[model samples]
Target chain A: MISAYVTLAVLLLGLALWRQTQPDPGHRQIAAGGWRQMRPLLVRIPIALIAGSFLAMLVPRELVASSLGDGSGLQGILLATLLGAVMPGGPMITFPIALALISAGTGTAQMVTLITAWSVLALHRVIAFELPALGWRLTGIRLLACLILAPIAGLLAMLIGAART
Target chain B: MAGQTGGKPARNGPPLLDGSTVFFVLLALGAGLAVLLLRGADAFNTALADGLGLLLLIMPIVVAAVLVGAYVQAMVPREAMERWLGGSSGMRGLLLATAAGSLTPGGPFAAFPLVLALYRSGAAVPVCVTYLTSWSVLGINRALVWELPLLGPEFTLTRLLVSLPLPLIAGLLTRGLLHRFSRTVT
Candidate 1:
């Protein structure tokens, strides 16, 4: 995850520098425009990740695993996905957390569910990024989509996990 | 045209690129580096080095998505997007978008940049929503990698069943609400 951030930063910086040195005024304008468009996400995503990391660490991995771990059934999958929606972190923290849960003997299904929820329905991204740019209606719809799909995605992941096992 | 090449109305909106943008890129990079240091430089370095490999893995899909986005942007007009795929009666559009999303190739990370380009190219809200949702949920690649290898065939089938309708559901609900609001105002 950290690597991803570094990668993104370097890419963005390269893009900016390229923009700065553009010979065409219009090209510079375009590059500058892309940069502006990306600003909020660039700023807020890190903050979300930071806050998410702390929150992820605070939650007991054992507790999470137990409640929505490997032994957890379909119901558990649903619960785990719901839990994921509330846990706002990046792939870095979430992936590690999920791996820990799996290692702890949590159901692989639960891991998938958790990841689906985390990636799709994170409240931090919703509040800080989506709502402001896309407007309430759009954000609300996205939230609805995420919440509605999370369980299904979890269920699918679990079923696949189960079959493999 | 979504402020495309020729939308320069002078007062269209704010200028692109600024100090804030630079700061954000710098900050994100700094934070990422910090994360690497905390985790262990050797492990982090190796992982970071693999980022390009990952990028290469999804390059084809990204290129396809970009072409699709550009085509959609060039061809789809605001009136058309609104009429067939806009807010209220845009159910078909939503479904189409969801289907397109389900078919998108590659991993989520690889797809992000291409999707961002789509968003920039005046793609509809529901379409973007569906695309993002379906990209992760029902990618063929995941079926091969994570689903088949780890989860087995039955579970993979079940997972697909569950994920199939998500993009549609998301797209419809989002479009429905937006349409409703738009109607209320007019």
Candidate 2:
């Protein structure tokens, strides 16, 4: 974690320096914008962490492991995909739950499927944003195009995991 | 078109307290209550401490990520990219859209408008799908800020490697599907 912070700090410094070199002269605005973004994160992260931790405790380890464990295979991946698509909210909400599940012994492949499905096929995002913005034709096309990706990714992850172990 | 773009304010930054935040707070409270009831005060305290400890550990990384995201967004040549996206096609267009999607910062609100704008300006359906797919599956901002810190590097790397080809594949698939659909319709 400390290493992650250091790396990010160096990267942030580099980006800040690059901004300084830019002609826009809106470094102050950028900083303000960052803070504006951070405020919501600040409010949500702790609560999410709490929720995740509590969830981790409440959810039976045996249940998680049995359903989404390494041995669960394609069935687990499919279930995870469904879970991911229906899961509500953004990363702040999703990541914590993911972490909690990880702690509770969810398999790597299943988690990968879940995250990929959530990112690509999130029903809420499609309904709330894509349909309204892009209209049905494009939305339908994109959905049909990308529908198979999450499961494929999950299966591949499982293969890689198998190869590794 | 101008009105369509102008009417929806670009929600680059989320509001401080939105519906999601309220929902999360309620979820946390309910979970906390459940823990307290099911186990006891001891377990409740432990869970709280664990959550707070995790928060403190990741806080600096999160802060750095937020700044990096903001600075990168500020620095992106949006108009130049739009111009590039507007006048490209074929495999090159798909590649460009994929790159743009991966690089695009912020949530759906910021991305969808740009995609819609690009689509309106005659970007190919495959290209648009590629861009949106790339944005959805491989966004650098989300990966850096959320995935790396929360999920750890191994999972992130594995997931990314598996997903790297997805946007292009989706683009190509969309191309084929659209062609067949057009033929059927005609």
DockQ of each model against the real complex? 0.13, 0.63
**Judged by DockQ cut-offs, is candidate 2 incorrect, acceptable, medium or high?**
medium
Candidate 1 lDDT tens digits, A97-118: 4433544556656666765676
Instruction: List per-prediction Cα lDDT, in the order shown.
Output: 0.53, 0.85
iRMS for all predictions? 11.7, 3.7
lDDT of 2 at B138: 87
Model 2 alpha-carbon drift over 4 Å, by segment: B1-14, B184-186
lDDT (Cα, tens digit) per residue for candidate 1, span B1-186: 123244323332343333443444454356456646666666455444433343344333322223233223223333443333233325666676655555554334444554455556666767778767776666653443333322334444565676677888777766676677688632
- List where candidate 1 sits over 4 angstroms from the true fold: A1-65, A157-165, B1-92, B99-125, B135-162, B175-186
**Any residue pairs clashing in model 2, and if so which?**
none
Query: What is the fnat value (0 to 1) for candidate 2?
Result: 0.89
- The true-versus-predicted C-alpha distance at residue B96 of model 1, in Å, is 3.9
Report the C-alpha displacement of residue B37, candidate 2, in angstroms: 0.9
Q: How far is A17's C-alpha from truth in model 2 (Å)?
A: 4.3
